[model samples]
Target chain A: MTRFGRMWVMTGLLLGLAMPAGPARAQEHAPAAAAQAGGHEIDIQHHIGDSHEIEIPFVGIYELPRFAPIHVGGLVIDLSPTKHLVFMLLSALIVALVFVLSARSIAGAQARGRPATGFAGAMEATTLWIRQEVILPTIGPHGDKFVPYLLTLFFFILAMNLFGLVPGGATATGNITVTAALAIIAFLVIEVTGMRTLGPKGYLGTIFYRPHGLPGGPGGAVLKVVLLAVLTPIELIGKLAKPFALAVRLFANMTSGHVLVLALIGLTFLFQSYTVGLGASVLATGVLLLELFVAFLQAYVFTLLTSVFIGLMREAH
Target chain B: MVHALMLALQEEHTSGPLTVEGGLMLWTVFIFILLLLVLKRFAWPAILGAVEAREQALEQQLAEAERSRTEAAALLAEHKRLVADAKGQAHGIIVDARQLAEKERAAAMEKTKQEQQEFLARARREIDVERDRAIADLRREAVDLSLAAASKLIGERVGTDTDRKLVMDYLATLDGGR
Candidate 1:
């Protein structure tokens, strides 16, 4: 293995061990044991309730806040920072590293053996499959052009989702901010691709022009205009709704999976039974596996849908 | 089913509204946009171009292989044709050799028959000449015998003139008959 490959493997191993075991150990030891062991618990007191936080030496702080939030205009809004951003960055880095390594393998003049292997190969196969099977088919002639965007989105979302499943890791996608940002990016790409394909005037005109099958000229034009005006907003609303939908879909999936696992785990604590605890732990672990699948699934779905939406937008009316 | 899933998701997120600070939201948007632009410019084009180049290279290799196969087939066919022609020429040579041998044998037989006929004719001519000489000798011997007998028949003191007259008479009669 190259030095880079060895480093990634080490990093993956460290992350694999650190992410789950650290949280589990903290949960087991309790505040008293942790203090006895000379471990300090950084107490992050918030508006809702007091929660225990953990701090890594070089890494940022970690905490899980309560469900309650600050209300504005009858809307309860969450303002606390979740571990979601850290996971998001980590996932992005992982994806970038994998692609960079794969790209390097291809760029090298003398590449031996299989082109795809380890994490890099797996990622390449997935991206190629999506580009060929999903994006190109949906997008048509220029479909290949959008491959990078779709691939990046898929990996980025996937990494974040997987990270969330780790015990101490938070779901960045669960936060509206992260999902909304991703959605906006999709929205921009779709619009830009559409604008580039259909000139700006043509794109705008599509919103107002309705083809007429009926015969009274002025009346037809008027009726068409009125119908188009109504449809335009609806179309616009649908466009807005897509990214919102994407964000919510991913956020909800990650959050629900976490919540379910947490609830299952909490049952043992509530009942104070060793058998129940063990059973719940087993169930939670199974759910965690399912969560892993969902992480990848949601990421794929989000990227695929975005590509499809962009493809549709780029089409001639 | 999709609707139900969406509804469930909504219900789960309904617990709190996430209010991101405007500045952070703006910054997030800017960073994401920058990321997309940078990716589009730098990473994406390179990656896509590489993939395309790889595909083209594979296609070119396939075409080249096909061309080589066709050329090989053509060469094989030419070789086979040349071999067939050589075989045909060999057959022709064998046929020509047999015909020439037959002609030469006929000429030799004709020459041998002519020589034998010439020898037979020469031998026949020599036998005819020898037979003629023998006939002449026999005739001469007969004539001598006749003359002696005649002389003995006549007495010793008999007039030669009378015997000569007889012989002359015989000669005259022979001449008159001729």
Candidate 2:
């Protein structure tokens, strides 16, 4: 290991040794400290997971507005907003506001025959880069129509991912339901694009597993049936697996990073030692930086994969 | 179907990491759809269209510039050719003028030489005619004087055709002998 790596390992070992020894002394303080530790333990999960309350920094936790469950026949569904839902709305609002303002600024600049400036310039560059690099290249030439949808997905997910790093914000993208919904949209777009590009007969070719150049006899007919029977289920699974992977990958990556950061901070309270708290703070800060990187990475991966899947479906063999 | 989906959602919502809140999904779908519609309508066209238009304008300007450059090159070549043609025409004019001047000078010299030769020939012919006339006159006068003197010496009128014939015959014999 390099010097920095060795030093980090040594510091980790020292913290590991001191953490267990410090808790014994922490027990000498009071029962109230133990109660606080239990509270911190519970807070870690609630902090990363979706809940009914929003925790504002320097403000007490506030319960979200509750609504009566919708009932249809024998079914009851809770439609009240939760913490993640509130943040999701915030992300959407931010995305809409920024893009709209950028649109205006860009339009004005274009009218004046000048280039875009300031935040508007940055937004334009990002939009162009995403369209030219991510969407058009992966989704091919006809992907122009899909630019707005994919751009929205990229920015919205990115906004949600970054919001999770804020002191009192929740990551909507970390939720399975949220990722799954986005995935479902992507799945629909991909499949529908395939259906439209390849007519009904052509689209069926993807699922039916018809091979070219089969023999010209009864043996060929029997072989064709056997191949269809064997390959159809596999083709169906392949189609479904794309969206499933997109949803689970985004959800897992976003959630895991938050869990690690929360768990690290929770350790400071659990040990009840100033040294452990300091160590945990440093470690948590590092992990938070990694989480920040993960946020953008996950967003890009989700968008790229979605575009690739759409392209693949459009050009299915 | 609604009951079954609700049951599954409820079960997952209370469960561990794979919690599926139906409300969150509904909210996501609602927000995404709305955002897509609004942004697509208000934002994408203006921004994307402007950029594409700017790119097209740049390409057109570049093409026009290239065309003008090519036209200028062709015009320059034509101008150079015209200059060279004018220079060649001027050279041809000078050569023709020199040749005409040389021909005229040679013709004038030939005409002057011919005139001098003709004058010399005429002068020689006139001189010969004058000499012949003077000789004839001298001969006639000699004959007349000889006849007069003979007639005076003889103291007789012998001035007739016979005396002229005798003198003419004597002159012919003298010319033949000389």
Candidate 3:
């Protein structure tokens, strides 16, 4: 067999052997933790709500909360250091690094065959794929201009989503506030691109233009105006609904996947049975794999739909 | 008690909402706009220029390939025409050589037949001359024998005078009778 074929075969065999052994090991070691627990079980804190109480050390305080709020000019801000913000900044840095590296690669013409490498190649492939497959096809000519924004949105959401999967990690996307911010950005881009391409008058016309076919006559113009007026609230609501939907969809999917994995793992503690723990362990592993797929899928879906919305706004009709 | 608990929860929920009220939104908007501007100004033009350059290069290569293909096809056609012309010339030369050989052979046969006829005529003329000479010699011999027999009966050999006299007398008698 060819080298690649043999490598694939070896990989498949390794996975086949490893998959069963993992569950078996979990099954074998199930009751040891329960025996150690005796009457008192070890409880790990999983705080879902916003407010969390924490104990401070060294300063001889009776009680202390995990987080505090600071007010600045009537604005109350949470002073707690959250990992989500770190992940966001990291994502931005990663994007900057990718662009800088790719730019450097092309800067010197003498460097042949050095387009992109490793992470850079992956980032470029993703950007180019989205531009060619999703954006350009939907947005038509001059669609390449929006590639950076689209790529940024995709990687940002992806990094945030994957960051939540790490141990003790909180999902920024799970918070409605973060998702709403992203959606609002998309909303702004769409409106701005539309206005820039079609002018303000054309933009308003896009919202109001209706094909003529109704039961009324000259009165129909008034009816059209009335209908448009009535539909204005609905259109505005729809615009808000888009970001809300984006936020909720990502937050719900990520939260639910994590919850399921946690629940499966929790089952072993609730019931001190080896077979049940083994089954749950296997199921949780499978769910983890699925979560990986969901991470990428949600990111792609968000970026693809956002680009589509932008394209729709940019369209003439 | 329930009221106090509700108030506590409400305070908890409402405490931080105002602190970052417009600040976060403003920052997000500012950062996003900055990102868009920077990307548009710096990164976008370079990326697009590279893509366009690559596309143009590909198009140029394709055009060159097509031109070369056309040139090759034309060359092949020219070569085929030349080969066909050469084949036709070769065929014509073979035909001309065959025709020339046939004409030369016919002329040679005609010349050879003329020479053979001349040789046969010369041989027949020589044979006729030889036969006439032999006949004259035979006639002279007979006359000599007749003269010898007559001299033997007269018991004397005939001399040259006698022979001439006999020939004259014979001739004179023939003229008188005439």
The per-model DockQ list reads 0.11, 0.27, 0.08
Off by over 4 Å in 1: A1-82, A97-134, A209-234, B1-24, B37-57, B106-178
- Model 1 over residues B115-164: C-alpha lDDT tens digits? 88888888888888887677556545544455567666763443356655
lDDT of 1 by residue, A1-317 (tens): 24522442343345446345222422332233224433322111111111234444235455645445566686555544344444555666666666666666544522442254565455556766777887888887867768777877777777767666554555667666677778888888888887888998878855555665755789887887788888888777876888889878876786676656545544544454567656766676677677778888898899879978887888757
Q: Evaluate residue B5 in candidate 2 and report its C-alpha lDDT on the 0 to 100 scale.
A: 21
The top-ranked prediction according to DockQ is: 2
Give the candidate number with the greatest lDDT: 2
Candidate 2 lDDT by residue in tens digits, A1-317: 24522443444445334432112112222133335443334233444568787766435568988899888677666789888889999999999999999999999999999889999999999999999999999998788998999999999999999888765677889889999999999999998999999999889988887778999799999999999999999999998999999999999998887666545544655565557766765776667677788889998999999999989888899
Candidate with top TM-score is 2
TM-score for each candidate, following the candidate numbering:
0.66, 0.74, 0.67
lDDT by residue (B1-178, candidate 3, tens digit) is 2332233235434323112324334444554566556655555555545655666778999999999999999999999999999999999999999999999999999999999999999999888898768765664565577677878888788757769467556655665675
Q: Pairs clashing in candidate 3? A: A54-A66, A75-B18, A75-B19, A76-B18, A76-B19, A77-B19
What is the per-residue lDDT of model 3 for residues A1-317, given as tens digits with 9 covering 90 to 100?
24522442343334336542122222222233234434212111121222233211113212223356667887766644333444445555555666656655543331352354565455455666777887778777787767778866776678767755543344556555566678888887888898899999978766676545765778887888888887767767766777778867876786677556545644655555557656766687787678778989998888888888888888856
Whole-model lDDT per candidate: 0.61, 0.79, 0.60
Per-residue lDDT for B73-152 in model 2, tens only?
99999999999999999999999999999999999999999999999999999999998898789889988889888889
Q: List the residue pairs that clash in candidate 1.
A: A84-A172
Candidate numbers, best lDDT first, in rank order: 2, 1, 3
Model 3 C-alpha lDDT versus the unseen true structure? 0.60
